[model samples]
Target: MNSFPVTKFYDSGKVHTTDTYYELLQLIDTKNIAFEVPKMGQKLPFDSVLGVQVLNVDSKASDNNDASIVLKAKYGKVSFLLTGDADVAIENTMLPKYDLKSTYLKAGHHGSNTSSSSNFINEVYPMGTVLSYGKDNSYGHPHKEVVSRLTTVKSKIYSTAVSGDVTVTTNGQAHSVSAKAWTPPTTTPTPPSAGTTGKLQVVKKDLSTEIVSIQNVGTTDVAMAGWKLVSVQGNQSFTFPTYTLKAGANVHVTSGPNAKSGGNYLKWTTANIWLNSGDPAKLYDSKGALIHEVK
Candidate 1:
């Protein structure tokens, strides 16, 4: 038998499921698996392969639905927020803890009214949301209010009930989503990895636009939290928040009277921080270590 990666559980005692615990325990014992109970903000060691952030897991969850594990994973330019039946109360706790913004969201609780709160939807700001549910199920999933909320956020919606399967594809720079009924998979299959591992560099600087572009040239996504870009001439710096720059993807740090964040842009400052003539930019990692410098 092939060994698997260490299993990380929120809490062993709190693990609840519809399936019998004895069966699960038997499997675990047979495998002799090693596991861990990670903390709330702990990032799994699987970062080498893909960026994974454990956004939420409550040992004291009031019910099984609330106890679900919520995670946000990023590979290349696409990010996925997978909420496992977590409800509104769980969403409330996760709001202030992490940057929920993502490219795609697997709507929690089958898009039920119990989850996908207005604040949560606004925070995640998903580009596309997939609601996995049954067609004409007894209990109506993807409630009217939830649909309205996602609509207000302007996220493209996909449903399993309508389409047999949904497929999303992306390069580090561009992405597309499509759906089709599932055949026997006689043909279609799914897809990034190729050079250097964690190399990040400041690729471009536009003085007039107050834009400094930072890109991950390597094949692996890099965690850029606490990384900051400094204006050498102005002596001002913009510190990055919790974020992951996917392999070959870039994030623009903008600073000016009208600086703002939308899509791949990150607002550095409202006041001008770059000179019109020219200015050098320096990038630093979380440890205040210099990563790249651009003139």
Candidate 2:
């Protein structure tokens, strides 16, 4: 199945330095891998990264959500946030969710001024940040102000243009980093606004076959009791005798089946709209409930 990777990058609260769609295609060509690129608002495949669930590729972009992708791959909490050339407004809203002191961040938008806010730097507290760019390329990558911000926070920095393929390896407990042509710079960037909202968990999971989990993203608190589960086979609907949850509430449903064997599929729905199922499942809010089944 073809998948879209941009939605994930955008939702994670970082700017896109290059056309990621084009880059993925290039990767496929260079590596001779068979892959398909889906339309916007799609979800990528999910796998266990360092013991945590990670869907590296997916499309979940929409009018209500920003363009970013957040990866929680265990290895000591490293986030590769792509903002797609967004300005300071976007960065300010995103820096607070993760641990700045320990997290590893990917510099936003080729090091543009529109990004890299002071408030963002304080929250990311990244152990080391990477700037992906080309040597002496056009956009004047590694912007001076952006660099200054890093220095202010005393964050170890690396540049892809100089370092070649910057790679960060983590074991969910500790991290080991190495880069080619990477050189530490001594400059920083001007600070920008602290975004509206800090960070949020977009995807959630559980064992209940009927209802996996609940997700509420908007400012208003949406109820979950009204939502029902739809089976993947025959598109059947299983009504919830009694289930009520407000927005930002993570409720787990113990009234569903476990999707252990193949051929069994289901989704959560509210009225005619589907909340957790199919592609949108990746963006489940779940408030914070543990949705699973019992033996």
Q: Please write out the lDDT profile of model 1 over residues 128-170, one tens digit for every residue.
A: 8999987754234667778888888888888898886888887
Error of 2 at 42 (Å): 12
Writing each residue's lDDT as its tens digit, candidate 2 over 163-222 gives: 677777765656667874344443543322222221223234432233444444435544
Give the range where candidate 1 is weakest over 10 consecutive residues by summed lDDT: 188-197
lDDT of each: 0.74, 0.45
Q: Name the top lDDT candidate.
A: 1
How does residue 147 of candidate 1 score in lDDT? 82
Q: What are the runs in model 1 whose C-alpha is more than 4 Å off?
A: 1-13, 17-19, 47-49, 180-295
Per-model TM-score versus the true fold: 0.54, 0.42
